[model samples]
Target: MSHLLDNLTVHPDCRHFRGDLPCRPNKTHGYVCESCPVYAPVTSRVLIIKLGAIGDVIRTTPLLRRLRQERPGCFITWLTHTPAILPQAEVDEILKFDFASALQLQARQFDVVINLDKEKEACALLNTISAKEKFGYALRPHDGVAWPQNQLAEHKFLTGLFDQVSQANTMPYVQEIFELCGFDFRGEEYVFDTHEDKGFNWNQLPSSGPRIGLNTGCGDRWTTRLWSDEKWISLITQLQQAGYSPVLLGGEAEDARNRVLHATTGAAYLGTFPLPQFINLMHQMDAIVTQVTMAMHISIALRKPTILMNNIFNSHEFDLYGRGQIVGPNRECVCFYRGTCQLGTSCMEDLPAEKVLQAVAATLPAATILR
Candidate 1:
C-alpha cells in the first residue's frame, strides 16, 4: 500500500491515508486521501462550482448537505470565492477560484461535477473540468457561453434572460438548482457550522424588546434595488416608536452611511464584524429587514423571520422556507437586471414605508410584535 502512495496526488498539508487507516488527521483539514499531502486512492469524488454573490454561495449549500447524504464519506470539493461562507462540515476540500486552483481541479477526476453559476467565466471553468457526469449550467460551444447541462436546469435556464419567463416560473431557486444536480429539494435547511470560538457576548446588546436587524446596503452591483435612506430612517423611527429595537447592519462600505443612520435615527449600530461574528450578531435579531443582500441569506440560514425588499429581481426565484415575506414596489419592474432605473421614479422609492413595515410585522413571530 505504501508503494501505491507515490501514484496519488501529494500535498504538503495532508497526511498519507491508508484504506483502513483511521483517518486520524484533523478532519477539518479534509483533504482527499488520494490528493492529500500523502497519497492513497479514494473511490468516489464530487466537485461543485458556484461562484460569486456571496449570498448565492451560502444558499446553494443545501446541495452540499444532499451530496454528503447521497455519498457518505465520498470526497467532495467545492470551488467558491467565498469559502468562509460555506459550512466546514459540508465539503472535504474548498478550492478558491484562481489559475492555480483551476489547473489543479481540471487535472482531477470526479464522479460528478455541478456548476450552478451562470457567469461566462465559471462556465468556461466548468468546461475544462473532468467528470463522469456533469450537471447544472455548462459552457456551450459558443465561446464558453452558459447553457443548461441537464433537462432539470432548462426551466430556470430558459428564464435566465427573459423577465416574463422568470416571472411565470414558480420553481424556487434551491429546488431548481437541486434538480440540476439530479437531487430533490427536500426543504433541507441551510447548514452553517458555527465555530466554537465564535462566542459573542449576547449581553453586549440592549436587553430590550424584540431586536430587529435592518440591512442598509443593496450592494453597488444592483443600485436599482436600493431603498432610500429616508425610508430606512422612517422605518427605524417607527420600529423604535413601536418598541422593537432596530439594529443597523452593513459591511465596511456602509460604515459612514450607517453612522448617519445611527446618529439621526438612534438605531443601534453594532458595526460590521468578520463573517463569524457577523453571523453571531445576526443570530441575535428576532427578525430582519434586508434587500437581496448576503445578510438576507444569513437571516434565512439562521431561521430568523425576514422581510425581503425586492424590486428588480424575480420574486418567484426566492425560497424563504415560509419564513419570510417579499416586499416589492406596487408597480411592475420594467428594468430587470440593470443597476439604475431609467424611469422617472425609482420603484424602490415607490415602495412605501407602510408596506415594508407591514411585511416586517408579518414575518415577525406573533409574540415578538408588540402590537
Candidate 2:
C-alpha cells in the first residue's frame, strides 16, 4: 500500500507540474517528478491584470521584463482582453476578461497581484483577488471608487484625474508603470511576438527604396487627431517625389479613406488585414508615420523608425525607445485628451505635410536620400 501511494504522489510545486494533464517534460522524457533532471520549482506566483485597450496591453508588456529579472522562475498569469498580443513564452497563462476567467483567478492565490488598469471593473476584480501583496489601483469598499493602492501609484492616479497635472507631467508611461510596481525602469524594450514564421509573404511591396508606411486614420474614437485628406495627399506626393515608396496602412475603419487616398495620390494601399497579419505587414516597412493610435504602439514595439503625430495628449507620456520622434502642430492644441476639437477647427490642420515630411526625413536612415 505504501509503494502504491508513493507512485501516486505528485509534485505540485514543480514548474513542469500541471494538475490537469501530463506536463511537457513527463510527456516527452517519461520522467517522474523524483527523477526529472530539468525539474524547476516555482519561486513566486505573480498575476497581472491589465484589461485595457489593445495598445495599452502592448505597451504594458515591458513590465514583464522587470518581473522576470527581480523574481527568477516566477510563474506569471496575465489577464487582458487582447490575449493574442501577449507573448505566450513570457506568460505562464493568459486569461481573457470574462466571467469564467475571473472565477478561476479568484479561486487561486498568488504571491503578488498587480492591476495596471483603473477601470471600475478592473479595480473591483483586484479587490476580490487573493494575493499576499497587491499593487496598482484598487476599489474603495466604502465609496466603490477606484483609488491608488500604494504611494507609487499615486502619481498615475492623480494624472488620470486632472488634465493640468497630466499635461505638466514628464514621466514616460514605462517609468510610471515600473514605479507603480516598486521597480525602477531600466529602459527595458517591449516583448512583442511578431509571429514572423506564420507563413506571411510580402514580396510584392517595393524593395529598393525605403518603404514608408503612412497610417491613415487615428480611429473614430479620437477624431480630434485626424489629419486632413489634403494633407495626406500632399505628404504622399512629397514622399513619392523624394524617391521614397509610400504605402498606406490602416484597419477596416480607415479602409474607405485609405482607398480614396490611394486613388488620389497613386500610393500603394494593400487593404487592411487582421491584427496578426497587420503586424507582420508593418514589420516589412522601413519606417512608419502614424497618429496617436494602435499603429504607433506596434511601430514602437517593432522598433521601427516612426514619426508620431500628436495633438491632444502630453508628448512625454510616450516612450519611443530612442527609435522614433513625436511631431506636433506648430500651435498648441486646445484639446487635451478630448475626442473632439474644442476650437471647432482641429489643430491637426496646423500640422502641415511639409513639417511631417521634414520629420520623416530626419527619422529615416541617412541612406534613404532620394532615389
Candidate 3:
C-alpha cells in the first residue's frame, strides 16, 4: 500500500486516496487503470524549455494541451523570454530564463524535462538539470555543444545544417515538435490568452462589411518575405473596391509604414499595440491576409480564416489546421532560408494581388458586401 504512493504520482481528485480506501479489483470495481478513478498519473513535475521569437513561443503551446491530457494535474513550468502571448491557464509556472533562473532550474527536480531549443546555451542548461526522463536537444558535455537526445528529435535537428534535408522533409513544425518531446501530434489547436485593449474598437468606424486584416510587416530577420509598399497599397485599394474593409496590422517598426499605406490607400491603421493588445486587434478581423509571420500563426490559433503568402520557408513547415492556403511564388524560390534575395528582386513580388482578393472573398464572413 505504501508502494502505491511511491510508485505512482497520485491525483488530488482521487476519492480513494489512502491505504485504508485503496482501489480494489472486485466485480463492482473495474480492475483496469484506464477506467479506474484512483488510477495514478505517471507524470508530476514537467519542465518545458523553449525560448525565443514570439511566434515560435506562441505556436509551442499546443504541446501543453497534449501533455495535460496525458497526465492529470501535472504541474508544468515553461521557460521563455516572451511570456506576453502565452496562455496563463495552461502553464502552472513560467520561468523567464536568466542566471538566477538557470541556477534554480539546475537545482530543482522534474519528472520529465523537454528542451526544444537547439541553442548551445539551452542544450548546456538541459544537461545540468536533474530529471528521470529527458528528451529533445542535449549537450555533448565536453565541448558544450547541442545534439538530439532521441531519434524523433534527429529528424528536425538535421534541418538546421542541411538544405536538401529540409526540402526532403514533409513533417509539420508542430508534429516534429511533439515528436521531439516524445508524443504524437494530434492536430492540437494553439492555446492563446488574447487580452483585449481597453478602447481599441473597430465597431466605431464609419465603413462597412467584414474587416480583413492585412499583416503589413515581416520581422527584420526575414526581410525577403516582405511585400513592397506599392503592393500593399494596391492590395488595400483592391480590397476596398471589392467591399471588404482592410485593416493594417503590425508592431512598432510597422507603424510608420502602415501609416503611409493607410493614408495612401484609405486603409484603417490600428496603431502599434502590445502583443496582447495586438492579439485583441487580430481577433476582430473576419479573416487575415499575412506573410509567413507571427500574425499569421496568431490568426490560425484564433481560428480566423487565414490567407498566407510564402516563398522561402518550406510549405509543410506550417499546418494552419486546414483553415488557410499556402500561396507561394510563381517561379521556383531562388533563395531558401535566407534573409535577403541574392537575385536583387525578392520572389515574394511574384504573388499577385488579384489572387489574394479572391481568397478574401471566398473566406469572408457572410456579413461582408458580396461582389
Q: How accurate locally, in lDDT, is each candidate?
A: 0.80, 0.90, 0.81
Among these predicted structures, which one has the highest TM-score?
A: 2
Task: Compute the lDDT of residue 366 as modeled in candidate 2.
Answer: 33
Query: Could you give candidate 3's per-residue lDDT for residues 29-71 as a string of tens digits?
Result: 7444445654544348789899877788878889989988986
TM-score of each: 0.86, 0.96, 0.86
TM-score of model number 3: 0.86
Candidate 3 Cα outliers beyond 4 Å, as residue runs: 1-43, 196-207, 365-371
1-371, model 1: which lDDT tens digit per residue? Answer: 37766776444333234334546453557756553554534457888888877888888888877877887656778898988888766667787888889998888778888888898878877788888988888788766678888797788688887767877888888888888777778998888765546667766575677888889997788889888889989998888777788898888988889999999988899787888888888887889899988888888888888899998887877888998799899888787877878886678888888887888777674355442
Clash tally for model 2: 0
- The residue ranges of model 2 lying beyond 4 angstroms of the native Cα positions read 1-5, 366-371
- The lDDT-based order of candidates, best leading, equals 2, 3, 1
RMSD of 3: 7.4
**Which pairs clash (backbone N, Cα, C closer than 3 Å) in model 1?**
11-37
Listed per candidate, the RMSD to the true structure in angstroms reads 4.9, 1.8, 7.4
C-alpha RMSD of candidate 1:
4.9
